[model samples]
Target: MFIKDYISKDYPAFNASDSIEVANEVAKEFGYSHVFIKKKGFYLGALSQQFLEESAEGTLATLEHHYEKFALLDDGNILDSIKLFHTFNSNVVPIINKLEKYQGYLSCDDVFCEFAKYPLFSENGALLIVQINNRSYSMTDVCRIVESNNGKIYGCYISAFIEDDVQITLKISSENLSSIDETFERYGYNVVLKYYDDEKEELLKDRFGFFQKYMEF
Candidate 1:
């Protein structure tokens, strides 16, 4: 989703000549990691809250050299903000135009709200985390495996990379989770983590009961 409409101006962007005390006050008020800096309608960068505290006294002008240049362009997708949030360790991301105009900002809370609207989060489903070799993995095969087992995939994505294997986390709706897990294994995928109801346990109990009866013969 394009972020043009989601731009928020609730967080103040201080001018370059703005007082350090005033800037710090606004930063503290908003509980943000950094306060945006702008001059002549163009964004400069950001001054971290910790640096603002150390500043004690001075104008933003004095700390121009310390500004951290990080911003998301206006054309960026909402998903893009997540990476920037993690990369910069900031709760807020500044938005700017291609011509260097300071537009507004996107809050971490707002981004999450946007995410919660997507099927990956909103739909009811069982989640699975499976591991596969990087060289042999195919997204097509993953989707095929789940769908062939009478499962409907709400969403799935590669969640991690561990040495030679990558873990894919999937949110799928189905009651045949036991069969799905076994199917993944048969297709060379390791079902490392799975979340579901008690169907698997019930199946195990029934199998154990059958084993005990057979032993009595």
Candidate 2:
């Protein structure tokens, strides 16, 4: 789970005194938009690819004014990479220790691959998206609502916030999909979406219910 496990040294960190050409070569070679610069075994910051292309010739230290400051600690989880990836718009994210020593980096691809291994993404199940007031939600209540209806929740996360309400997305496995939907509504949850699989099973259930009602008469 720690970021250090996936740290890649594929892209080398540059010393500030290193030549602009050396940094440019590495940046272009790896197709990275930013290059990590270091001095005395500690990371200074990063200089964007655009800055290197514009400067005619100088040491990497000369481009100090153009450095962008951002990095993940080696101990941070891979999930932390998503925010940095969006904020910096970098193809690869740098990793550093608490002392600010440069560790390595994980590319955007690496982060995605790691995320794909999690049950929330990798598991096979239907997705239910429901909206409820902020004060109306709790993990226990949500889990109870799903499980009481004979559904098992694989995982759940807040999908969005609307005014004082929050929308939650849960990956769940269930045979009685309609029962789960009905249960959520009975509990005051606004079911925005129920992306269940196995339509044939649902159709069979409906037919069986019709037969039962007919026999009752």
Candidate 3:
């Protein structure tokens, strides 16, 4: 799942001498929003389509163009690459080698797909949304509550509301909704949402009849 596995060798890259027009054409042909601009084993920056359309030059090297901070990495694990990709909001990131030379670009989708295989919990799990006292957001309290109810805590997402209330979204491996709901509610943990809660099937069917009339050939 590392960058080495997902790095795309086929991605179209441009050289310093390449015309801005050529870069735009390559981007259009490849259906890419941005094109990598490189010089002899080194990545300079990227050329964006939006910048090309707005400027008079409409070229990669024009003064009117700008690029976001390039995400760089020498060698890293899959976890490290995923963290960098999310932080930079980049689709293609440059991977550097030990020699500080450009190796290739990692496609964001490929990297994410690999990381998703290892999730916080297994697919057969339920999520509980609990509202606790504003001061109680510690892991100890969360573990105590889940263990008391014979539920195994798979993962937890802790967040604070705008009104200073603490909310803990705990993922448990228990599918017994009635028992889990009653146990948490007894402990004053307001259950706002449940991930395993069954949806109202008729809701989608009812809307489909109304939506079908708007469809035209």
Which candidate comes out best when scored by TM-score?
Answer: 1
Model 1: residues with Cα > 4 Å off, grouped in runs: 197-217
Q: Tell me, by lDDT, which candidate is best.
A: 1
Q: What's model 2's lDDT at 141? A: 87
Q: What C-alpha lDDT does candidate 2 achieve relative to the native structure?
A: 0.87
CA lDDT of 176 in candidate 1?
A: 80
Candidate 2 TM-score over all chains jointly? 0.84
Residues 1-217, candidate 1: write the lDDT tens digits. 7988799988889998899999988899889999999999999999888899989688999999999999999998988888889988999999999998999999899888988998889887689999999999999999999999999999999999999999999999956888899999999999999877456777999999999999999
On the 0 to 100 scale, the lDDT of residue 116 in model 1 is 93
Question: Better model by lDDT, 2 or 3?
Answer: 2
Residue 70 lDDT (model 1) = 93
In candidate 2 the C-alpha lDDT for residue 196 amounts to 63
Question: After superposition on all CA atoms, how large is the RMSD of candidate 2?
Answer: 7.2
Model 3 Cα lDDT, one tens digit per residue, 1-217: 4556566778766776677777777767766566777668667776565555555644455532475546456457655766655666556666677655667777667666774664444445677888867765566867776777677776777755747678888777664566878867777778888876233445676678768866742
Candidate lDDT values, in order: 0.91, 0.87, 0.66
**lDDT tens digits by residue: candidate 2, 1-217:** 7898999987899999999988888899889988999888798898878779888798988888878899999998888888888888888888899999999998998878887888878777789999889998887888898898888788999989999999999999856778988888988899998776666678999999999999999
